[model samples]
Target: MSLNGKVAIVTGSGQGLGFAYTRELARQGAAVVINDVNADTAAQAVAQIEADGGRATAVVVPVGTTDAAKALVAGAVDTFGRLDILVTNAGILRDKSLLKMTDEDFDLVINVHLRGTFTCVREAYAYFKEHNVRGRIITIGSPTGQRGNFGQTNYAAAKAGIVGMVRTWALEMKRAGVTVNSVIPVAATAMTKTVPYFQKAVEADERGEAMPAFFRHDLGFGTADDVSGLVAYLASDEAASITGQAIGAGGDRLQVWTHPEAATTEYREGGWSYEALQENAGTLFTAETLQSYGEEFLPLPEDLKPAQAAEAR
Candidate 1:
């Protein structure tokens, strides 16, 4: 999956998973545009990529505004001559339970993760159309969006919205040869380290200690690089056939998430009243047919190590 001569843009590429993606993409021979709100971090990332013999330029754009997004795309074209791939990885965590979450919290997360993705993709689409480029768009998604998480109502909603955008854009751009997809990654990056258990795992890893069993699943509680490989593959030409997908990349596991479907359906000759519906409630709503949220798909580190569970408690 050599990206030689390809020009790519990765938003929030100064640190964490975005940085990993930018580095890997540049390593594959693409001239990368690194966009981050922090000018210093963006310069450092650009310097590091250039130091490693990869071509990269920094663009300090916050990513939610239309002008900023357009400038980012324009900067890539001005610097690299053309654009081919876009990774909408800029995000922030404004976690709070629905009851406690403020309007500000909800709006910030939505603006950065959901609206930011929309603005970037919209600008990129315009550029791709003008240039007749078959662009690859890889949006960042989260498992919290697929399966709701406690105290993350806002974050989950925004992430899920990104996937919806990917689906619609995939259809809209299919005839133009542009592909849109989302990557749901779980890696030990700055974002994941915000969790207590993961913070411990990261600290332990830094000290050269063995991680708990749960953190060692599949390929282990790996670093950002572990997730970057999948993103790179999707950005490459080989993945042109794969669009409108939400792929999971964490540890050594790669998963294809099932799309929404109707699980059950019933028909009535006319509109049923509340009393009529109540008569068939038992058959319509059963315990086995109920859907649940807030269940952890992967075990926590403390769960795998009972002795340390006390600390987590």
Candidate 2:
């Protein structure tokens, strides 16, 4: 798990999960580019990594912008001479149900998650392609993308989009030897813990008021480090063959295969037509409909059913 001589960039590394990823990668011998909107936090993170005898430099930029994304890559290349790994871990949440969701809220979330990820991936792809380099791209996804969660319509859609992006990029970059994958992590972080709603959810669960089926006490919940470990592995050369994958990581648990179940369906032919299509559309669209759309197969082991394991962790 040594990243010796590797040049890596981690967005939102000023704190939380991104910070953990940056520090860990630096500690593993990779020259890290720490990115965040907060200059002080980013600088402090880099300083801490350096204090631990790790190589790191901070780049203050809002990761959702295209220019900033390019700057992040350029900074990595300029500082370390090459770009090897990228972790697009910058994101924000504006949780709201579809009905209650505002356009501004939706735009903000999409800009951060989908647009932000696109910005980073596009720049990295250009670098990797131009340099004829094989790079590793790992994005942060959420369980909300796997199983729908209440009050997170925007988050879920964005996360699901990331998985789709990874799949497409994996194929597009295959010729260049780059691999694209996403990590669907369940971690307790500042973003989650700081949210009043989230705190209530956790408190409720603790009081046995509305425990999620996957709740587990000994699993110690999830932390930033837990998710970073998986990100590190995905970016490693050992995982070269593991592109277009969505993995789950946490304490006392590691479920790499997280996807919707499958089923058969039908579609209406053209001219048979608007009314008929409208009536049958709901039946045609389901998690089952999406199962065959991707190339990777990472379904969980039969005994490790996700629904049941919800209790263990």
Candidate 3:
């Protein structure tokens, strides 16, 4: 009800977290434009919304092209008469170690996740500025992006870049009353179901069983619907003051990630010569104790981890 009378566009809404986002928006009374590359899934999403007495339409497009982006914004305005929210939820993953990853794999992932978000947000902002609408733009991010992952070079780059863009856009859109922020969500979706680290949790979810406390509390992993409320809240009037932030949500956990900053700074009269830096290297970074690399899992419960992963851990 908080989003009643609003119009929203959620890319990649054919299924998974994207679908959950659109469904939540529609439930709150927004007329949604569900976009996805697959026509069947898009139509199915629209039908589901309509069955629930919520208004929605399907916009089938790849979303990485400017033309596709243009069509999405136009579809929202053309179908619902205006656009108030744009949630860039469409993305793809091609995971491989840096050495094994090919150019095609990297490019494909970047095209869908990074370029797709860029094109969609650019067009959405243009519409907002032209119509003088104080629109909400929610971009998706990932934990792998925040904390480096072993085989997610492209994905991490794209997602981190998205948050970086949000910070800049927040400053630029301040006068326009447009809020842009990144939601770094961890959830059990098609995208994450195959992750060996979460195989057990995913199986439990698929069977309609609750995820173990270790995953929900310690790992911040949960079903897609658990992350939707934050997306909806960020897109509503109440979150107008929130922008330029990277918020994390999954299961019962919510976190506000601090922006990158210098943890230790010392007086440098001449910006420090190499010889002086080498001498002070020991004490320069001592205060922060070297931030941990990769996401720190809190030791999964023995029964909750994949057999091999559990054995390895």
Candidate 4:
């Protein structure tokens, strides 16, 4: 899908997935605004896009503030004449177990990933309403949010909150012909390098070494470019009907995640007593009836048993 004459503002576009999204949208004929906290990286990204014959400008500002977010949208309109798309891809990692996680760590991640997305979308939605444009808002999510990860309470909570915002905004903006969606990516990037196994696999791939058989099934699927293609499609007009959805992109795999719903319900003619609930709770909340939210990707060696894995941690 072509995005000619469209103007897109991608936050944290100086590097990683945000950069990939900005470049892809620009390459597809959109004027992109590169927003990042680092001025040099933002300028470098703009320069690279311009060198490739794409139109782009840089906005070096932190995304977590209301003022900064408004400035970002204003910059886009001032530079490109209109705002059409917003990609909230700025985030930070502050992984720690629940007991060990500090308030500052939790607040920082939420500020960047969840609140930052909210501020940007809020500003962009105002602009879209003022101009009567059918804008597209794409927020970034993470697998850790869908399936909880160890030592990542802050990051997982922030990512999950982002998805919640997307769903709510999608419903609110539908009448205005604007669309909102979330993209959960599982690509190998600098952010994923924090995990020791992922770092080793990336380093090995860079050295032209083959990954072990255990990791062969999933390692080195694709980079940020692979994720950007899905984001670009969602930004295009063809995906106008596709809102309030969470999409996953990695390597060649694209998936539509199921929305939360009631699997089953228990009711009575009158309010049940504590004794009744205590007796029936066993059957109502059985392990077999509950959905699992554990991590699916086990990067551990196959020879490691459950007990050994626990011990290793």
Candidate 5:
């Protein structure tokens, strides 16, 4: 009950990963504000939390606008009297390759994931600063954001942008003693159910079977609930010094992702001309010396290979 007497707001928390986040916060003794577009699911989430002997309320609204963000903070204070933690978890996926992705597709994803997080965090931080509350702000990110993904151009951009914002906000909020961090979660939820490996894991879970070790251990994919503990940890008093970090969590693993940094730097007096650069290009920059481009998709064992991928391989 480290979070006892605290109030929290988790957006897009009707179900899936967002729901798990709300439940965990409530379990930690925070009175929670569950925000979702679907009234039914939002109500259901509140009911579930209440049944678990935790206090909660629902705010049913789409979460990308300033109005909705304002309403959520208002809802938290009106319902629970204050806001101490905000999990900007609302997001949507528009999975299309660059060539096939439309402007509408890109904008829609950005509107929800990036703009929604921005508005919500902006409002929540204002409340924290005004009240002198040492608040915790946890923003959601994705593997696709940390590294390039094949067909998630919009998703990657939005999620990566979220982490970028977290780093900046952490610096800005440090004086107020508020912490801001990104949670890069890899879990089997509605958004990931379509992935072959996650599909297999979901099927296994539905059948009351554990996910294969390859997924949990190596791939870092697990049930949504498995990722909730990290969210809860970040929301607790113990995480006060853990700002500006991108922490990854899943089945059996937790990771600290390094902030972006220059891989290699070399000084050139007067900045070498094209002819000088050409002479040094091979020694300084080579295919073998560059960093990796995308997330590692380890080779799945024969029995664990996803069906669609099995056929192709």
Candidate 6:
């Protein structure tokens, strides 16, 4: 009952990680608003919660539209009488490499992940402020946001933007006792299942397609429940002091860190003179470079299966 009597809204809760979060929060005595673009899934989620002796209501909020997001906030507050927790978890993936990515692909992801989150959080904050209620805002991010991934430029960028928004909002909302944070999760959900590469990985495991020796030691694919545990914590009263932080939870692991480390100043008072910068350019490009260079690139895993590898094996 960590979140007892709290009212929460979880976007995209019809299935996957979002549904798990909604169910668990309600179980902990929080009344939850379950939102999904799919009407049936949202209704089913609410039904399951009610059957378990928990309180919940489901509403459909299509991804990427401001009107849908505003309506969702209104519905949650209208049903529950107030809002305490907001989980901005709704998103979609238009997988493609940057070269192959269309403007539409990029915009679609941004609209859902970035703009959609903004709409929900913005309206939720207004309600919180007007009611003089403290609030918790948790956004769903990804490892790709921390480390760039091939074929996920749009997703990565949108997630990275969430981190930025969290940090800025944390500062702005501090006086109002509103906490903002992000969670980076990896789970075996519909989103992952739909990814051909991930699906292949799961199938390969089932078929003994080069099962690694580490499989015995390593925790297997995470379920939605696993990620929901962290979500439950962040939504609780105990977590009020924690804000502007990211918790990476997946594969039964949790990691917390303050990102965009501060750097030593080599930025001298002068326009970019090639010679002056060259002297301390190395220092300038330390771990904390410009915000534009938000994330660092990592090489792909040696065991990663390429398209050709799938064909060959």
- State the lDDT of candidate 2 residue by residue for 1-313, as single tens digits: 4789999999888998889888788877889999988889988998899899988888888878899898999899888899999999999889877899999999999998899999999999899989887889999887777766778888888999998888888888899899999887766676666544234335544464642334323332455676777788888888889988888886546777644454664655575577887887777766756544322223333433444355566
The TM-scores of all predictions, comma-separated, are: 0.92, 0.78, 0.95, 0.90, 0.96, 0.82
* Separate clash counts for every candidate: 1, 2, 0, 0, 0, 0
Question: Candidate 2 or 4, higher lDDT?
Answer: 4
* Residue 299 in candidate 6, Cα distance off native in Å: 12
**Models ranked on TM-score:** 5, 3, 1, 4, 6, 2
lDDT of 2 at 248: 80
User: What local lDDT does model 3 show for residue 105?
Assistant: 94
For candidate 1, list the clashing residue pairs, or say none.
219-252
Model 3 over residues 1-313: C-alpha lDDT tens digits?
9999999999999999999999999989899999989999899999999999999998999979999999999899899999999999999888999999999999998898889999999999999999999999999999988998989999999999999999999999999999999999999998787778889899999999999888898878898999999999999999999999999999879999999887666898888999988998898867465677788777666777687876786
**Pairs of colliding residues, candidate 6:** none
lDDT tens string, model 4, 1-313? 3999999999999998899999999989999999889899999999999999999998888889999899999899899899999999998888788999999999999999889999999999999999999999999998888888888888888888888888888889999999999998876678775555565455655576654444444542456777899999999999999999999887667889888888778897676798888978989888877988756666566442244355687
The local distance difference test score of model 3 is: 0.92
For residues 105-182, what per-residue lDDT tens digits would candidate 1 score against the true structure? 999999989999999999999999988999999999998899988899899899889998889999999999999999
Clash tally for model 2 = 2
Worst 10 residues of 5 by lDDT: 190-199
lDDT of 5 by residue, 120-196 (tens): 99999999989999999999998889998888889989999999999899889999999999999988887777777
Q: What lDDT is obtained when candidate 5 is compared to the true structure?
A: 0.91
Point out where model 1 deviates above 4 Å: 208-213, 216-221, 297-308, 311-313
Q: Which ranges in model 2 have alpha carbons more than 4 Å from their true place?
A: 194-220, 258-261, 265-313
- What is each predicted model's overall lDDT from 0 to 1? 0.86, 0.79, 0.92, 0.86, 0.91, 0.81
Q: Lowest summed lDDT over 10 consecutive residues: which window, candidate 1?
A: 298-307
Model 2 TM-score on a 0 to 1 scale: 0.78
